[model samples]
Each structure stands twice: as C-alpha cells, then as structure tokens.
Target: MALVGPEEPHYCNHHVVASTGRTRKMTLVRALRPFRVVRRTLAVFTLGAMVIVSFALLPSNVADAATVPVSTQAVVQTAPDLAKICARLKITVARTSLCSHGPDPVDAFGGGARLKQTSAVQEQGVAAAPASELTALCNADGVSGKRIEVIYGVPQDRTNRFSAMVAPLRDMMRQVNNNLEAADAATSQNYRFLCTNGVDVTVRNVTLLPVGSDASFTFDDYVASLQNQIAFGLGPVDFIANERLYIAYIDQVQDSYPFGGQGELSIDDQPSAAANANNDSRPRYSMSAYLDMPVMAHEIGHNIGAVQDSAPHSSKGGHCYDEADLMCYDDGGLYFALGGTLTFTCPGADTAIDCHDEDYYYPGTPPASNYLATHWNTANSGFLTPVVSAATPPTVTGKSPVSQATRVAQTANATATFSEAVQGVSTTTMRIKNPGGTVLSSAVSYNTTTRVATINPSASLAADTKYSVSLTGGVTGIRDLSGSPLVSTGWSFTTGPAPTITTRTPGSGATGASRTASVSVTFSEGMAGVAASTFKLKNTATGAAITALVSRNGTTNQWILNPSATLAATTNFTVTITGGSTAVRDLAGNPVSTSIWRFTTGS
Candidate 1:
C-alpha cells in the first residue's frame, strides 16, 4: 500500500485498517499517535517550545523506576506528578445555570450527548467541576503541604525568586530549542514545525499549583469560570485557530515533591489516590517533565504528516523497539525527536536524548542528537538544493582494483570508491537483485551519520561469472537529518567474473551425529573474486544449517572446510548459493550463485 501522509492517517488504507483486527474508525483512531488526543486538543502550541519541552531534562536512569504491574499503581508510580497535577487541561467548560451542558467531559464521538446527567452540578463525560474543586478533593484526603510545596515550588516568596527559579528552567528549554533547530538545519528535515501550507506548532505556557492550598483556584479558576471555558481552561477560540496543534500548561490540585537525582523530564508518573493514601503523612510526589514534555510534542507531532505505528496488535508490526515511530506505544516519555525523530540507527548511550528516558542533564554528559538533522536554513546555507543533477544516472567510471574473497570461515573485505559522495541514494536502501528478479539481500546499513548498508549473502558465489547490480528505488525514503529525501535517481553497477572454485578439501565427509560443525568449501581460483562467505550447507530435515564454514586458500581457489562444530552423521546436505548470482559469474560468464546440489555425509 502507498504510504499514508501526515494528515491522512494510515487507516485510510483499507488494507491497513481492516488487517489491524478492529472496526475501521477505531483502527483509524488507533493509527494515530498517543499524542493525537493532545494534538486534537491543543492545536496551536509553538513548534520550538514543543521540541525543547519534550526533549530537555530527560533523565538517563528511568529504566530503574519502581514498577507496578497494576495499571492504577503503574499510572501513579509512572506519573509521580499526579498529586501536583491540576487539570489545567483546556476543556470546554460551562456553568450549569447559563449553559445547557452538564459538568462531565464529553466524548463527542462516542455519542456522549446521549448520556444523561441527573443534576446541574453533575459532570458530563467531558465536563467536570472547576480544578479548584478537584484540588479540594485531593487535600481533604490528607495529602501533605510539603508535597504541595514541591508542585508549586515555594510559590515564589517574591517575583525575583520566582523568576530566579524559573529562569534556569527557561534557559534549559531555550538551549534544547537551539539544539533542535541546528540539527534540523543540518539534516534539512522538518522538526516540530510542519509545513503543509504554512507552519503549525504545538505548545503553550504551563503552570503548576498545589491543590486545596487556597480557598479559590487562583487565576486558573477564573479562566475556568469563563462563559465557554473548557476543562483545563484553555480557550476554545485558540484551538479553532490552530486546528493542527495543541497549547497546554501544567497545574496540580495537591502538593507534590519533585523526585531527587532525576531530571524534571526524568521524573516518573505520580502514584494513584489509593497508593498515595496508603503512604505516610509526608506524602512523596513526582512531576514528570519526561512524560509531560514528550506527551506534548507527541500530541503535536500527530498533527504533522507521519504514519501512526499501529503495529502493537499485529505480528507484522513485530519490532516493539521502533524508536523511530512517534506512534510507538513504548515512546511515551522517552524519545529525542519532536516531529521527526524516527532514526535508522539506534539511540546512543545518553538516555535523555529522548523524552521518557533519563532526562537528567549534567554538564559534559549531553543527550545524543538524532543523526538526521530536521531543518534547513534555505537563505543561510543552501543545503536544501539538490546535490546531484537529475540529467542521468551516475556512471561508475572507476573502481577500487583491490578485491578479496574468503570462505565462510574467513572474512572477505572489499571497498569501492564512488565518483563522489552521491546524494539521494543511500547505502541502506541498496539491494542486490538476482536475474530472476528475486532480491538476494539488501546491501545497505545505517552506520554512524552516513548510510553504509552492506550485505554478505547467506550463500557463496559461483566461479567466473559476470553479475549486475541494478539500483532501483534505492533512494526514495532516505532523507538527510534535515528531512530531505534523496534527490538523485538510484544507480547500480555490474561486476567482473566470480572467483573459481577448486575442490572441497574434506570433500564428501560425514560426522558421528555431532550437532554443530563448520563445513568449509575451497575454490581453485585466486581469492580475489566475489564474496564467498555467503555460501551455506543445509540439513535436509528442517532446512537448517549445521554451522558449515568456508575458506579460501589465501592465494588459490582452494577452499577449506570448517563448521561451527561437527555435523550429524548420514545427514542429507544441500549447498545453497546466494550473494549476487548476476553479480557473481562463473568462469564462462555464467551466474552460479543460485546453484544448489545435494550430497550425503558418511555415517
């Protein structure tokens, strides 16, 4: 199926939606990122703010946080900021007297309007009493003042102190923003900012307050009391204007303490009411910037064009460690990217590089940057322009004359120099297609900052054959860190004859039913032909290999035999050839990479 665009969810593909094992709409909703709720809610936060807030302060050691199998306990422990968390969430709020709506929040799509409310004070599915009320409920339950102090941070004895405490955090946010912007420029990939017609950002000022400390809910209450005020109190008009993003702030109803030795981003979720109630009087608390910030961006990133990783339920979506997926459930508070963080390479040692991981930032130990940059300054640096001309495919005018081949037991090394560091075509996307149109294997891999995909086929190449390596669709998905797709068309090349195979040294042998053995096959030609390590010897039973090995006689085509261990006696064996059949020709310009034959070992 064609790739789904950002605004157009993957669910649009009937194949994807139906195959996910759910009703269509629900699958579509599932296809959206976790932040989809936030994106659909806020719709107008700043892109820069989103990136910084999401990635900065991620602690490095969150993997060690307390674990609770139960969802309630998990939520509480994972979100330690719950006590300090006030629902400043911008929701549609209205008083009962002037409004027909009830106090409960609405799930409009779920036919929430049909749900009945018994009283004016009653909460609709979507609406709720003011946050102040929530705070009162939290405090009356015996939550402590110290926890409250942690949530609001001493309420600033004076404006100066308030600014003093918030300034450093603000500076940290700014640094994160700058880093993202630079990386975006370097990679030419869009970051938090989305550019469909115009740029759309997601974020806003967040505030936190201790619950039940005051008789009134402070400014948040006033905002919540507005005629059409929504829950969490963000105005509805703001959302209407930036329909693609979300802007939200933080507020808590009760007192909570920030966890020590953890970055604000590194903090875990607050414990639930039941868990907190069972604790001591000094009630501990935690406000997670890690979960919060990424959640913010995750919501916003959903607004941008990227497919939701709705693979959790499908076997086809096997890799749970898809850090590149914004919709990946595992990405919750851990991830470095704002809009475009999916990477081909693994994340570095720095945990805070993403949102949910350890967010604690200290000097000298900086978070790892995504290899691909997300933005490009068109006016300053012209990296946005195409690097290669579209006139024709690049021709291989010269090649590295040095060539070496080895048996499965030995390592073969070869390096070819390109005319230039060609753009568009990445090493990872390069595939070696056989004459039968079957792809032997991909010849690309993501290495360091560059795409350096290589392949040592599972089977050996035949002797003296001419093979062709055609490059088709080799540069489509490859983008620089700045998110620019490869500009040039794909290219390929044909190589010289394959090395000659002499004879197997231990020709036609069997073992005493040993499980593992490295079987080696030698070649008669020089060890300068195609890669020979790709050969394999398989057992007839389950088509499994007995750890057979292959090696060349350093100078001649004489190959050696060695298996990881001895093989089973009287076992049926078949040789499977693979690497590049077309790329590896036999002595008479014939491809033999696919030639397979069977033999029996002595019992």
Candidate 2:
C-alpha cells in the first residue's frame, strides 16, 4: 500500500519556541501491520504511546455504504458514563454509538474533519471516516471540510481540571468549522446539501473526554466501545464486514527529557540533539500540542475520498516552503502565521506567508492547497474556527450526443452555474440499445435555459434504447450569475431502454464440466423481484424442465442462477428467465428481459 504523508514547507498558524533545524535519517521500515481483530484497521505508526495509522485499504467499489437509521432502543442502551458525558455537554446522541461509529453519523454535519488529538489514548480508536459520506457532507455544506476529535486521557490527578480545557477546545472547534465551511463553498459542489437547496451548514462541535473508570483500556477497548456503541453495534469486526470505514491513530512518543524539555524534534531523529550550551531544559507544553495537531490533520487528509499519492515539498518528503504541507515536519513561524495577517482576501496570501521565509524552506515554493485553514487558526489564535467553506454549489450541466451508435452510450454534462455560460448544444447524435452496442436514433434536444439536453428519435424515442448525448455548438449563449461568458467542456449522457438482455457470461453452445461455473448475465435495465419459483431450466433431449433459482445481490438488478442438479454428460440444456410474467421490472418500469439461451454440456 502506498503511504501518504504531508507535502513539504509545512504551514500553520500555531506558535512554537524554537527550530532545531534537524532531520531524522529514517531507514525504510515496513508499512503499518494489518490489524487482526479489526482486520481492516492496521497499526500504521507509533508516535509516543499513540498509534498513528489508517485502515489498510478499502474495496474497489467502496461507494455503496449502509444507511440503517438509528434505533432509539440502541441509544438507550449506551453505557452510563457516555450518557453522563453527553448530558454534561447538553447534547443528544440521537443515535446509538454503533450509528455514531460510521462516517455518516460522525461526519453528518462535518464534525469529523475539525477534530484533533489531545491525549495518546484517544488515538486508539481513530478510524478513517467514510470519504463518500465526508464528501457528501462537505458537498451538502457547500465547502471542503475536515474534523479531528481529541480524547484527552488524564490521570486521576489531572481529571478534575477537564473544564479548564473547554474554552480552547471550543475555539479550536469554531476555527475548524469555519475553515471547512469556507473551503466547501469556495470550491466546487458549492453547498452542504446539493441533495437539498443551497444553505450554510451549521458547524459541528468537538468533544473532549476523560476516560471512564475502566481498570486498563487498550486501543482495542476504544475500538470495541466505539463499535458496540457506534459502528454497527457489532464492534470493530464490522470494519471489515463493512469496509467503507477506515481507522487512524496519532500519538506523541518521546519525553521532554534529555533534550532539555524541548518540544522541537525532526520527523526522523537521527541523533538526540547535541547538548545545548545553556542546557535550558524547559518544557514547552503548548508547543507540543500545536505541533501534533497539524501532523494529525495531514495524516487524516490522506484517507479522504479516494486515497491519492502525496507530493511532498522537497520531493524526498522533507520540509519545503512552497506546499505549506504539514507532513514535512517543518517547524517555523509558518506553522502559526495564518491568523496574524488580518487580510483575509489578499491575493497570493498563503498559510506560509511570513511564517517561514522562502529561503528558510526549500525546493520550488509549494502551493498552499495542503494548508489546513483551521489548523492554521488553531496555531495562531489558540482556537478553531468553524466553517471550512461552503459545502454545495449548484449548476445545470448534462450529457452530449443524446445518443450513440458506434459504442456503448457514454455522455457527460456540464453545470452551467459551475461555468460562466452555456454554448451551443451538439447536433450530431445517434441512439442505440439502452445497453448500447446497437444503434437506433440520433435526434436530440438541448435546453439552453435549463442547461439540460434531451436526445430522442425525431419521433418518440424507443422506451428501452439508451441514448448518448453531447453538446458541441449551435445554441445561443446563456450567461452565468458571474457574467463570465459561460464556457464549459463537453458532457455525455445515455438514453434508456425499458428492459432488454444486455449480455450473458456463458453464451450459447458452451461446454464446461466445472460444477462451480455458474451462468450470469447483465440486463439493459433494473429488475424487480418475483416469486422465487418462476424461473427455470430444461433439458432439450428429455423435455424435462427444472425450476432453477434467482436471487438479488445487494440491491442490484443482477441475479444469480442456481441449477438444481449437475448437468448430464453430453446433454443439451436451455435456460429461460421470465420477466413480465414475474415481478421483475426495469428501473424505468419496463418489462424485464425475458432472456433465454441454449448450450451443450460436456462430461
């Protein structure tokens, strides 16, 4: 698995006392070890006592996530300690912990993106939030966003003072929220709920906690608690069962000792700093806190949406000024300079501006995209700002051609609002079988006002023919709210066929003896369920028929074919799937594909 680290030239708005200007020469080490109990959640790295890591990897088709609603009974069963904590905060965990464990609930309002780790133990259960849900929430809010919930595990000696940390925590939450909202709105997908209308997302809060009276709590304990109470009420095992979720943990490993209570350290510690002349071993508590926040943010950023490769500042993954990357381990003014500059909109403004001079950092000055606006706020102002940016922005854009004949229909749409205006729609078009592979009609229509184009035959389009459409030229210009002469790239779309047989895995005239070889097929449309006994297979020679079986996989229209008995050697077999007669129907409400095929069986 490719490891993700921050880009270089670390930037933040936090303060620190010194710059060691040291680099730890690291030897290539094995990547995180896979977790056993939670097969998917691996131990990524050890930072102090905290284990900083993310889920191993998610399945390819990771888009489908579970959506079970919260159950009141489940919430009622939560441990009293958690309930008391919730009560003290005046918040209601409408859903049980199990529900809270998944990305959907934890990040419902973009809360997960703004969190940070306050204590090592808290990092134990740090799991990756679902990227789709996070992205969905970010899009809903019309901004790019992030969350980092810190669990502070203090000894009994420091327990009572938990209230003292509240103000700073609240501030951090606010800053993180603000940045998230801003990023969401300022970027694409402008609002939180494109599913809903445009609206600012209400900022979510960050929760800090003191451990319950458990004798000894291991990382798995937190995982279990979160799982039983939050994930699926089935605990961490569900992580693999439901691969959509990933986990991560970050902690401080070294002491403020021999180094003279100093917080500054290199990403790699080649050697403990040479004894300082003054031997001024004064502890810097806050600096330690500040440094860890950005590191945590950069790591979690790796697991977001689709995991992508990191482009470090020095290219070798060391500190550099251009990227404003927190992963490079650069400790300088840049970490806490974002808030100092009051100019919120100065062009070319960066998280690194004045924090760390370009000369002090290296390689081409990296871009500022990697900067965490909220973390920058935390370092500068001792708090977080809500509003990562707007979540959802809207526009009308759609598929071109409206039809295709040469290949499977492929069309795309462009959101006019996202663009400055709409150009002429494409006239060249052709229609084909809904599943494509067959050409039928080409006539298409474009709505310049709505920015949507329809492709159909000059007459009524076929009910089941999927049409591919595009927009090339010919329509009058439609300007956007920005008045920037609407310009956009091309788009595509597919027409629909009511229901038709698309393709079958084992075509007619096949001969295979493997009993495990099952027959399967794709349809032009979705199908509904019917009485299980409706489908069947038959032997052509004896005229004896058997009622084969069909079952749905996940919610897809695809079905499985179960043969009742082994095929006779050297025998002719025929399979038939009845659709309209059964309960099956395409998504368009068209009849199911009454498909049939015949093949010879070998011994």
Candidate 3:
C-alpha cells in the first residue's frame, strides 16, 4: 500500500456497479443458463427414477442409492462461468489452485472434491462442491488451514530498544485478526477464515553497512543483506508443509516512502528446500519498524491474493481502487456491518480510512469487490481462524540488595532482574536517588542474556545512608519482550555505619615532639569536611592558641593540620577537637569524637 498519497475519493465498488457491468452481467446470465438447464434435466430425471425405482427396488436399496455420492466434476461442468471465475482469479481448491492443469480435467474437482467428499460421505449423500470454492465464486474467497510465521529482524545497536516495537507490532497483529473476523462476519460467503497459527519473534544482531550520500546501497540491497543475515543467523526454516514464513525487518533506519512493507504473493527461493516445497511455495511479506496497523494489514492482504489485476472483479487500480478498502489508498477502517448499517472505526485513528457513514459498506448491496471480501471468509476455508489465547506479559521477578534491606555495601551496584528477557532498560527508566531526593550520577546497562539491569554510581554511596532505586512504568517506560511496561516501584537500601577516626598524629603525652611538625588524623573510612576550626593547637601553660590550616587527603582519607607558625619553643602544646561545633564529619554525617590530647614541643 502507498504510505503517503493524495486523498482520492473513490465511491465504494458496492455502490457503483463497475463500468463493465453490461459485459459482466451478460457473462453472469450466460453462466447461469447452464445451471438452469441442468436443474430442469435433474428434475425430469428424478421424477422418472422415483417411479421406476419404487416398482423394482426394496426401501433399503432406494435409501442406499439416495446416499450415493455425486461427482464434483458435474457441478463445475454445469457452472462453466463460475469455474472460469475461480481459475481466472487463481482461487485455490483445497490447497491446489483451480488454474493448474494436471490430469484433472474438472477444474474444480481436484482438491475441492476431497474436501467436499469428507463432509458428503459422512452425511450419506452425494458430495457437494466445497462451500469455500462456491463462496469465492459468488463473493469473497479464502483458503483455510494456512499458517504464518512472523519473524522480526533487529540490528545490534537497536537491540536494547527493541521493546519499543514489540507492542506496536503485537497490536498490529491483533488489528489484522480483528479486521479479518469482521470481514468474515459481514460477507455472505462461508469459508475457514485465516488465523494466526503461530507467531515467533527472533532478534538477530546484524552489522549494517553505512549508507553513503550518493545512495551507494539501495533499500533492496539492505533487504537482500538482511535476508542473507537471517539465513546465517537462524539457519534453515523448519516450517510444516502448509506453514508460511514472513520476515519483518525492524531496523533503526527508516525506509523510503510508499513502501512501509512489501511481499510476494508466492516466494519460491526460500532459504530451506522444505519451506520452498511447502504448499505451492508459501508467500513472504516484510516491513520495517516504521509501520502502522493498516500498512501491515495491507501488505499481508497482498500476500493472500487480493485485488489482483488478473481477476475479473479487479480494476485499473489493481489492489488500490476503493478508497475505503483496506487494499485501497485509505486505512480501510475496521468495519463490521449489521442489518443495513455499517459499523466502522479506525484503530487509534492512526489510519487513512475516514470513519464516516458514507465511507463504509452496508449489507444487501453488492458486496465490496475488494480485498475485504476476496480474502475474509470465515467458513471452513476462511483465511483466519479463531485465536486460542491472548499473549502473556513480562514481569519483574527479583532485584539485588533486596528492598528495605540495610547494611548494604557502599560500593555495591543496584540490579533488577525480570521474569523474562527485557529491553529498553536505560538510565532514563531506572535510577538511584539518595534520601535527599537527589538522583545519583550513574551508568546504567542491561544484560539481555541475564535479563538484569545494573546501575553503577559514579562514586561510593554515603555510609549509613538510605538510597531509593526506581524503575519507571508507563507506555514509554521500560518494557519486556511482549512490550508490557514494568510496574513502577521503589526499593531502598541503607549503607553500613559511618567511619570514625582510628588514629591521630603526635601521640598523647609525648615529652619532646618537634615544634615544626604538622598534626594529622586517620579515619576508619572515607571522611569529609576537613577545617581548621575542627582541630586546635595551644600553649598548655600560656593559654596561647595557634592557627592552623586543615585539609583531607581523598586517597588516604586522612586529615592534615598545618600550624600557621612554628609552635612556641619550650612550650607544652595541647590539641583539641571541639565536640559540638566540630566541622569534620564522615561521609555518612557522623561527627568525630570530641577529645583533647597534648604533646610538649622541643625547647
């Protein structure tokens, strides 16, 4: 589908009979003529057989004859125009296309007969042509029992942020399924609807070559490279015979416009021979991270064989004729019609389809000859089946330095572990704050393998201090693989006790210490706030105080006191730490013990 385009208002195909209506009407009448003739012939034959059988056969034989299965070939031969439409539209019978010519002279009798036979034999009657094939002839068609696999390609640099795309993609899938269901219910046809058989998301790390200004590498080249990368990363695809493999490349770079996603109706050169050999070569589709629900739904619609130019119902616009159709230029509003009214709305209003009464398809009118009808039958052959269950969300299972635990090491890194691997764990989502509400400067890293996120503070935390670590939760917060956000919660931890002075320079009661020597103190742990007022030197007998400069060595956590002048000669000097007014304190705010110790200077 074109990602960007001018708004071209095209009337619903259901309302405006095509310009080729006369020719098609003639063709339809011609097609119905043979069916009328066959019905008349069967009516005459039934009357004759009933009279003859009653006279010659027992009641049991009559019942047995009535239960005999009829040839599916007879139905197709009688309705030549319907067979022509099925073959021309490339509609499949069972899993085989009606167009393919094998030994099967009856175009509709090949695989479709088997499907009908299964039901007809059980009902003790002639097998009727599969309802899905008949439905496709009358209105929209579908192929049931088809499987699709969704694989996501993630570049190495964007692995951590991969969670950002998860929710959007999952939502897109849900919308796709819902749209299919709505289409199935609105159509008059019956077929097994397409269902999400299985979805697998794999994150493959790839090194993308730099794109040069001259356009050294094209987007196709990148896609080819990514295809090769997937081959090398995941090896071969081991899907079943009916399963399809679709690769969606979620890159950090945006793709060129009008190509949000694209895929082939049938992929022949799959990585594995088994996949290539499966069910007439299952189709493949791809999209970038920059994709919306409508775009994705449109691309996948192409893969399912809709709006093809080759079909009689198709028009000049190919898959893009109806403005309000999903295959059209618009978002094909999620619609379900009831009675005569159309109920329609776009998902999150992020699509181009105008959700107005005029933009929708009503019942009883000619069904919209668009992808909506062509691919959305819910009978046995409908493109989508019912989903079994909803997806599971990821959660946080454990955290380091357990919440409210005390005596945690000052240098320990804070970590959080999730129940499953998660991405988008950055400093913005996870943080540590001191008791004062200041966020600590730290580097955050997430280990995808371990599913753990670690926050390493730039410096050791304050001793005996309480700190809170939090993981933000919201639509934009950290998310798990399924794109569910973590529950916002804070966990606090307290560091061990504050450090104290273990030793001091100039032992107390020393008789003859050098007068020029400086005084110093050593602490049991890191300390701060060294100042002269915290330590004082004075002449013991004269009561003369000496000024000193004070500073702490960060490496050693030692405070040095340098006297302003040489101590008085032949004086007994005393050093004191004023308890109440002392400015010195450890990193955890515990002040040093107040004490006085003296040593006599040399005479």
- What's the TM-score of each model vs. the native? 0.23, 0.24, 0.29
Looking at model 3, residue 224 earns an lDDT score of 36
Q: Which ten residues in a row have the lowest lDDT in candidate 3?
A: 14-23
lDDT (tens digit, per residue) of candidate 2 on 1-603: 112114222211111111111112222122311122232122222121121111111111113222112220011111123223323212121122110111111111111221222232223332222122223233323422222223322222122333443333322222222222222212221112211222222222211111223222223323322222222221122221221212222112122111101111112111111221011121101111221233323322222210011111121111222322222221222211221111111121121222332211111222454322111112211011222211221223322331111112223221222222334333342122222223334554445565454544444444433332222211233223333222112222223344666776567667663444555666655654333433456787787875556665566655677676666767777776665411344433234646667777667
Q: Which one wins by lDDT: 2 or 3?
A: 3
Residue-level error in angstroms, candidate 2, position 497: 11
Report the Cα lDDT for candidate 3.
0.41
Q: Given candidate 3, what's the lDDT at residue 592? A: 55
State in Å the error of residue 485, model 1. 21
Which tens-of-lDDT digit does each residue in 202-228 have in candidate 3? 223343323333222222323333334
Name the lDDT value of residue 333 in candidate 1.
22
Model 2 lDDT at residue 235:
17
C-alpha lDDT (0 to 100) for residue 203 of candidate 1: 22
lDDT head-to-head 1 vs 2, winner: 2
lDDT of 2 at 509: 68
Q: 1-603, model 1: which lDDT tens digit per residue?
A: 223234322122111000001111211122431223333323233222233223221111123222212321111123233222211112222211100000101111011111111111111121211221112112222221211111112211112223322322222222222222222111211122212222111122333222222221222222222222233222333111211122222222212211101111111212222222112132111122221222222222222211112211110111112332222222212122212222222232111122221111111222445111211111111111122231232322222221112121212212232322344443334443332234454344333333333444445433232122322222244334443333211122224444444454234444343334444555434332233344667777789865644665476544444666666677777665443321333333233344455666666
